[model samples]
Target chain A: MNREYKTGEIQAGKPVQQVPWLEWLAAGIGLFLVLGIFGVIGWQALNGATVPPVITVTVENVTPVEGGYRVLFRAQNTAGEAAAQVEVEGKVSTDSGEEVSQVVIDYVPGHSDRRGGLFFTRDPSSGTLAVRAIGFADP
Target chain B: MTSERYAIGLARAFGGAIIFGLPLLMTMEMWSLGFSMGRGRLLLLVGFTLAVLVGLSYFSGFEKTFSLKEDAMDAFAAFGVGVITSTLLLVALAVITFDMSWGDIIGRIALQSVPASVGAMLGRKQLGAEQDMQAEEERKQEAGYAGELFLMLAGALFLAFNMAPTEEMILIAFQMTPWHALALGVLSMLLLHVFVYSIGFSGQESRPEGGTFLSTFLRFTLAGYGIALLVSLYVLWSFGRTDGVAVAEIANMLVVLGFPASLGAATARLVV
Candidate 1:
């Protein structure tokens, strides 16, 4: 804390009067970030939608596991609101019977996608597979 | 020599940012809340945090400041350090990826920067040399009653911000009955008073000359607890914990969060 002050920079018991250029540079960067963040949020407030989450689930692939078949799917929320506890159901219509597999995604944010896997005892590739988001809870 | 001191201060600011910001930075709830939270509320929060940082700089900035302009500059500099630190950490952790929207990235960084900036502002007091701390102590004594309350508010906000983003706040509230809430509230206030007045921490304040126990309790302890509760509510609301929540549940949550907030308020002198 032993600051070296110039002749005119200090008065009796007062802090040094002159600020360094580096301080100003740091402050400028901060100001930019603050303003930029504010602007982005403000823009979103003006234009962001308030629609409920609309989730679309699509199966990515089906693979064989040791005991069963694994169906990987991606859940995409196209709406402006996020959803929690989203239920994605995959149904397979085979010559033998109809098999259903369900998986719950914890969260699917607006305009974002989440991947999950559903397990089925029967091979999903052997039947016509139908995958869709059944329901979602508001986040 | 001045430049060298400033450089050291800057490095300390970075260290402080990491130490204070790490908890919130690693929180999964905080990362999600950034994008899920209401944009208007998020904006208000960022604006409010900047104001708090400026006030903190006035009391104990990274450098000795003689004027409001100096304090404001330091506040902004602290914010810059916070934003940079948050951005770098988020990237390293894979929380901020190339595929994410710019909005999500900005939101995450903005929310995290609140605590990081406060840490940077307090870097001087926590990490500075001994003589620097003495100077800050002198500056703190110059503050009056209003200033003391403001410090309490800042302290409460800091602690509440740390816990409010977690799901446990609401979960604990839901688990508590009305009787439990009442007991916890009383216990929180009692602990807060003991920490500030009864116990003699290193930076503890002595009772003012001729100040009676009742007067001190009413003026500092009670008022500090009130501020703590208010700050807790604000933090909870900012994190969207109050959305669609029942009134009784909200009250319970307030009590739960108020416990830590009160401790933070009581320890303001030692910490802030």
Candidate 2:
């Protein structure tokens, strides 16, 4: 009968090397762990507890029209991206002799540039046009 | 038991150093000095040759045991591997950050790393040390490696906060000077070495617990200064004014400075 060579030694074929499958599996798991960690970190970093929307409303053009002022606005996004689900709102006002006239308009799911036109068709002799923006300020 | 194993180990250590160190040094020096790759390559070539000449001076007493030419070649291979590994990592980072398209990033990193790796390998091999001091040298090498890694982290951070143009973080991260980076890396390592010694030499057993704390406190305080020096320079240079510094940005900067110091501490703990 064949016998073993020595202590701390075994036949070339019989020697049980570290389980290849286990090693591979372990390595695979290790890799996944590393990737998962990085992915989670990156995700959390890019969009964490508070991530502001992409596009932001910034006043671009305000001009006086026949009846009311034609207001033009732009959405500035410096985060290297485009954003959706924008809402644009405008408020126009004029002060007459003793009375103040005001008009409010809202734009939902506004187009690109977060831009939508608003005509405050107020009586030219009544008051002035005042425009203010609402929705999405990246602070 | 045999000297051959030790020689191989030395070769690996030095080889690893060259494989890694060349690209690092070159990147930093060139960047700091405002030299591009083409000019930097020329400088690297000249500087590497000079370093080899200087490094070889140590073996003037015994030439038989060590071969400079052979070491240089081996160092080149190791350096190539190091550059490849680093470049790949850089490329992957760029891709993930959406800084570079897969095609552009891969092409650029691969192209730059290949030649840089070759230069690094050669530079490392050329830098030689005596065989008699192998054990001590190996310890030093390990310490140095830890130091370099920490320094790199610091340097990377410094670059990220200061030199990296916010509009082009990805590009600048890759394109920053290798030679300057390496110098800072070496400096960081040196600081770590001193820290290691300070901690190791300071006796704690005979003294009161507060005494040990005091010594550690002193050691760490000095270490803090060293980190602060780099961070301060970065802040002054980048922000133009240290006043009104953003807390988060400061944290990021400190993270960079702390990287190498921690590395040195960890290595010292492990080795000593």
Candidate 3:
């Protein structure tokens, strides 16, 4: 098959081959990504730990919404496992009474943060606002 | 090769990557799986993807290369296109932001690159000009029994990979009773056989020369279904869906994933 192809090539008088600069560039990019990703994953494998999710929630800010005040918070997972359906509860010690609000975050990956908002009828800033991650399900 | 021709091929690769990768890219579970999945499994997946790409290039690559070296190069080029396309789409979707750690960004892009690269490799057949496709069809006929099985495996893996990362595979498995699992398994095999052998789909493979119905059915459909089940199991394991599941539940999940996998295997010749 190679010989037949070569003879046919001769008969057709094939043009001089153009340099495959684009192909080389693409291959180079691919090579770089393959190596880079391998390196990152390898590094993680060597140094990473497998621990249960340790979630911490902190209040970011409070803003007024339609019917209530929105308390934006960030939930951070510091361990090596991901958590799903993370329930974060916010408690505010208001002068009238204590206002409690809760929000559920869908997922928080290990060593990552997810943002969510909790609604309260009263301004949380008027009192000490405390936000804590109540619990999480294994993802 | 002319630069214009190669350029056009590259363009088609990008198109294919986007078309194929978009579903996984938009999937929320895939994004989280990037960071949450085990590093070892991720590495294994990447390695398998490269091997599949090389095999695919041998059968029908973006370029018609006769040598293994050229095929490898084409595979890498497809991978490169896949990575670039995945990165751009991920960024545009805001799935990966600058604030995320390098590990997260790299993990997300690398995971997504698998489907994108496969799409890029398949793009030539799906999007190439009519004359080029005729040549590709002829080359496909040259692929023998082992090659046919390999294509089935590739197709199975493609569909399985897409579905494995989602939670619904496990959820659906949990919902199914044993009877449902058995019925689904039988239906998968039956449809796989019909699509590949009986139906007159484009690129359908005729029964083997001098082979009877039972022989063809035993050799191709049964083998392809087996490959699909295996591929489905492997993909589910890679996604960590089988880590703590019971053996019975795992079997159910296997049958559930095997449905799309069988379809993919059945349509490998028509699509890939």
Candidate 4:
């Protein structure tokens, strides 16, 4: 610490009591950041014991489109990898068998959701509707 | 040699990391890549990034250096600062956690370390320029072509660093038609050339008049675009965007990313 030379010997000999605002600020930020990081890690560890949820496809809404009925479905992924080209299938039980409708979803990132719609020329309100995740690939 | 100067440099470096490297730290794809990217690929990317940092240090570093050795040393030093900065921030954000494999933590930090390191380097130049009063005489002389090229790299790195980590690069490529991609490429080149011409850097005076048009467009514009493409490719690859993608799709993504990189390249001289 350099002291002013012009000052008297007593003053000059005194330790320079200068405040390093920037260094202190930096240290403060760094300490705050380190503490914040530990806090977050602790929070996450408490919250993340649960495994990534498997994607569950559920029919969200059924509405009438121009030509046919459009069934909106939501695909939720629990895993870390993206589910690409997700194919969601809708099967309506008929007296005869099962009438199926499938829609291709572009992608759904892990721990996220994507919406897609399936079109059916024939009204399926007359039967039981079931939707399932048929397949997916990495994007 | 004052501690104040060191503190200021460090403060500026932190600012640089936030300014230049923060977006990627928050990017979802980047976080995903930290886990998905193979170790070999990650290592290669780190090696290449270090090389570019050393090269940039020679041209426009946090502090000017007279020798390749100094530049190399500065590169590693900046890298150390960058890694520590990035790791701390990422952990603060909970981007790295104990649940993730050790590989995941290292990969994420190393990948983010590139732009953070560059930002650290730029912090010195951007914040400490006033201290360089003695170098004014040496700086006045036009930087050679290699210097210009490095400047372009810096600019491209600055701009591309923000966009490369996003999912938008692939999303945009997927959305574009062939015509759209072509138009983007043309526009990128045109803008790159026009931006440089508008700036009229002193470095331009070196071009002789006879074949000036051809030389300028070919030598600078096209070359800048090339560097941008390389940068885009590197960024995309480092982020794991290119893995398992079709060749055409990769090319499209490259062009999409190259647009900003070329703009960065074109405007390098003004920023530096």
Work out the TM-score per prediction: 0.91, 0.26, 0.90, 0.64
Across B48-93, the per-residue lDDT of candidate 1 in tens digits comes to: 9999998898777787776777778889999999999999999999
Error of 2 at B241 (Å): 15
Candidate number that wins on TM-score, 1 or 4: 1
DockQ of every predicted complex:
0.46, 0.02, 0.50, 0.04
iRMSD (Å), candidate 3: 2.6
lDDT per residue (tens digit) for residues B1-272 in model 2: 13453344334433543454344333422221111112223233333433332232222111211234433433333333433454555544442134332322222333233334433333323344434344323333443433333333333332232332122322322344555445555565555445544555431112223556556445443454455445443433332223355754443443344444344343322321
lDDT of 3 by residue, B101-192 (tens): 66678889989999999999998878987435665665666667888999999999998888888879989999999999999999999999
Give the candidate number with the greatest DockQ.
Answer: 3
> How would you encode candidate 4's per-residue C-alpha lDDT over A22-56 as one tens digit per residue?
43454355344333433433343344422333679
Please provide, for model 4 over B82-169, each residue's C-alpha lDDT reduced to its tens digit, 9 standing for 90 to 100: 7788999999999886655443466567778777878877777666656553342244243557667877887897788778877777
Give model 3's docking category: medium
Candidate 4 - CAPRI tier? Answer: incorrect
True contacts kept of each: 0.62, 0.00, 0.61, 0.01
Lowest lDDT sum, 10 consecutive residues, model 3 chain B, at B130-139
RMSD of 3: 2.9
Chain B TM-score of every predicted model: 0.97, 0.31, 0.97, 0.87
Candidate 4: C-alpha lDDT? 0.69
Instruction: Superpose all Cα atoms of candidate 2 onto the true structure and report the RMSD in Å to 1 decimal.
Output: 18.4
Which tens-of-lDDT digit does each residue in A69-121 have in candidate 3?
99888898887677888999999898899988888888887777888888998
* Model 3 spans > 4 angstroms off: A1-19, A62-70, A94-96, A122-127, B131-138
Q: In candidate 1, which residue pairs clash? A: none
Task: Tell me chain A's TM-score in each of the predictions.
Answer: 0.81, 0.35, 0.77, 0.59
Order the candidate numbers by DockQ, best to worst: 3, 1, 4, 2
